[model samples]
Target: MMKIGVIGISGGWSSEQLADAVEKKTGFRLIVDFENLLLDLDTGTVWSGGVDLSSLDALMVKKIGAQYSPALLDRLDILRFLQGKGVPVFSPPDRIMGVLNRLSCTITLRNGKIPMPPTIITENVDLGLKAVETYKEAVFKPMFSSKARGMEVISPGLGAREKIENFAKKHGMMYIQKKIDFGRQDLGIVFLGGRYLTTYARCARGDSWNTTIRSGGEYKPFDPSLELIALAQKAQSLFGLDFTCVDVAQTPDGPVVFEVSAFGGFRGIHMARGMNAADLYVTYIQEQLDKGLITY
Candidate 1:
């Protein structure tokens, strides 16, 4: 039997679902939490809950941390080290590293000519203020964030400067982007193995600025046009992740990408499309391992 481990947060919905799927397939279940992980450099061993992570036949990253933080980068470094030791990590740690930070993902997308909202990155309060003024309304995003957390929408008016300053104080580097009017919904276009898998929409409830689930958004099945799917495919292809979701918003001009997710949500796909993404993903991983496609 293959011993495959899922690196994720304990008690996390998606994490647990993935572990269950893996267990069903391989009869071995291990949910490796980064918080409980210990790496002994001298022995070149990664120990977590008395299990040697480097001994696993393959590893899948479901989630690195419970919340997004700079510390997640350090956790990924450990995964990279394991990969170097010949354990095939799904999606590869280096590829995930490229998309973990907002700035790095933005740079890659922009360079690929992917359509995105006008964005500005700076540590200067004055520049951030200017960006707010230029765009009229801007979204202040942390470099490391997910599900619209640590994000604030600031309109150009009274207290704009103070808002920018306060945000900059909290996050040394400010990522300001022109807030596009995406109506009440945005699309989560999923891709598995670099191919389009499915699409879902997060419909906003109440008057939230973003359509994240935490902000009272609900997931619904969506049928996207070919153009939209192509755009999302292009954006996700830039990262080459084994599994990912491209957040795209339809604007007056065209569709613009928000970001490529490092670990795509399984709940949304399940709730909206009635598909078992965890089962599908586990099957894909098994097929890859059987074909010798996943290699160190």
Candidate 2:
């Protein structure tokens, strides 16, 4: 029997559905909170009170939740250990950090030769305002967050910087970037195995940047521009990830890299496309098992 391990058993609506769907599709029972199976480094024996995750055929670190302290963020370390021991982990732990943060995502896009809007991320409000002044159309967002929690557009002469500073003072620093004047719609490219699994776009009626869930932004299938497809593939390869959803915006300059969600949502995409992301996930896990890459 193929055993698969998943994280975040109790949180996240989409991941919960994905886990249940995975079991139905693959017939592989999932063990949640498998990070509790971590081994004591010096002893080289597994920890207590959880499934023997070391025996699972594959593992998926379902978008980890916010850890208030460093000690609470041990799931990634466990995943890395499993990977080092030849277990093929989904969205590899290192890659998780690579795509989760806005700054890291932008940096990766630049390093991978992907196109992106000019960006300015800082704590200084004056510098941020200057960037908005320079670009005339910019977006200010939280440095580390999901669900477009604090995403806002800054038009010319808008007194958004002061508001941003006030928010920043309460939160942390903000990462701001020039918003692309992309006409009409944006694309959400879900990729697996370094290739495009689905290429679709979403269009908002008016004043919308996010297009999948959380914003009531409606979507229709789209054929990605060759450039956007190529960039997405390059990013997947660079991260060496098993699955990723790369958000791209079409601008006059071409496709601009927006965000890369490592632990992306699936119910909306599945509901829209009538394809099961959970099934795809299971299939990928089995493929890894067949190759003898995953142990346990």
Candidate 3:
């Protein structure tokens, strides 16, 4: 049988259970819970988790959480090393920074002519303040963040400059967007294994500006038009994402993509579409193995 692994911390929830379920249903040998693995040089070979990690056929990254103790570089190098050895690794670690960093993602999007709201990226509080003055309102974001955490709205004469200074002092950079009035709602479309998986609408609850579950967002199923799918897929292709969720919002002109998430949770899609995205992911891996995409 083919072998695979999920390199992530067991969340004490369905992430682990889901891995087990996929193993049982797919008949693939799986190694779950490979986080915090020790990397050591054994006669010039790097071994992690007390085993040769490159032995696996393929690795599906369920989590790549930021590391401090082990150093993020160490974690990233592990994946690159595995891929270099011809073990198929989903979402190559090398490609991650370019896609995850807001500034880099924006550059790629614009270069690819992907439609999105105007953005101002800077370490300068003065530039951010000017952006708010010009655009009426701007949304400030950390270069690396998710779940809408640390997101701020810059309104004119509202001490926005002071806020940007404080933010820059901490994050050292900012990704600010001219807030597009999407009317409290946005669409999140999921793509898996280079295929469309599902789409849903996330609405902010009770006047909250953020449409994230962390910010009291609710989801419902929505069938997207071809134009929307094409747009999301275009973003996905630009990122070379094996799996992702594309966040899109509708402006007065048309739909504009705001973000493409590298690690997306599928609870909302499961709730609305009654589909287990986890299953599709495992199936995709099996199909790849069958096609000999994951080399030994």
Candidate 4:
């Protein structure tokens, strides 16, 4: 039997969902709340306490949460161990970190030649204020955030400048951008196995920016733009990601790249698209398993 670890922070909704999907689609059992496999570097043995990492074929990393500890070094060490061995880790660790940083992602989009709104990563209040003044609108977001959390929209007379400064002081630097004027519309494109599974939804009646479950934003299937398809493909290639959720804004100027999520919101996208996305992900894992790929 081949084992594939479905990882999250012990137990999270998304993790549970993915585990179920993998079991159903690929016949890989879920190992929740247990460290089934262990590697003794000194002894050069991989054991499941009783089992072994050699028994595992792949790993679906569903959640990579915020780590504010110096222990992040230890976390990276474990990731490197598993990956270096040969286990096919879905949404590989390096790509996950790459998509999490706002500034790095901006550079990625530019390098990939993807269309996006003007953006700046700065701690200087003057520059942030100036961008808002020039464009008459802008958005302030943490370098690492999810689900439209910690997102803000700036407009003239909205007292957004001070807000940006205060936010920066507390949360490191921010990614500020001239707000896209799309009139309450946004797009989320999920790419798995180098294919686009797109969805469209409004920003919830009065909301201008965020359209997440917390904000009561509903989802529906919609056609994707040629540009969107192209950008999504380019982004996946650049990240070398097996899966991602790319958010885009429909601005008056054009579609703007909002952000790319590595452990992107899989539940909602899977539910809304109803294209069996989880199964697709499991299929990828299954392929890795069938190939008998195991690092440990």
Best by TM-score: 1
lDDT of each: 0.93, 0.69, 0.75, 0.68
lDDT of 2 by residue, 1-296 (tens): 66666666555575676678667756765546543456767754444245555666667766566432234336677767767766567867877767766787788778888778888778787887787788887778776667667677776565667766776685566687887777777777888766688876667765666554567777677776677788777766667677788877877777777878777736546755877777787777777778865432
lDDT rank order: 1, 3, 2, 4
User: Where is model 1 more than 4 Å wrong at Cα?
Assistant: none
Model 1 error, position 46 (Å): 0.7
Worst 10 residues of 3 by lDDT: 65-74
TM, every model: 0.98, 0.84, 0.90, 0.83
* lDDT, candidate 1, 78-155, per-residue tens: 999999999999879999999999999999999999999999999999999899999989999999999999999998
| Winning candidate number (lDDT) | 1
- For candidate 3, the TM-score is 0.90
Q: What would the TM-score be for candidate 1 when compared with the true structure?
A: 0.98
**Model 1 lDDT, residue 236, Cα:** 91
Clashes of 3: 0
- Cα displacement (angstroms), candidate 4, residue 145, comes to 0.3
Scored against the true structure, residue 35 in model 3 reaches a CA lDDT of 58
Off by over 4 Å in 4: 25-28, 31-55, 66-77, 157-161, 200-203, 291-296
Q: Output the worst ten-in-a-row residue range by lDDT, candidate 4.
A: 67-76
Q: Against the true structure, candidate 4 has what lDDT? A: 0.68
Measured with C-alpha atoms, the lDDT of residue 170 in candidate 2 is: 56
Give the Å error, residue 200, model 3. 1.3
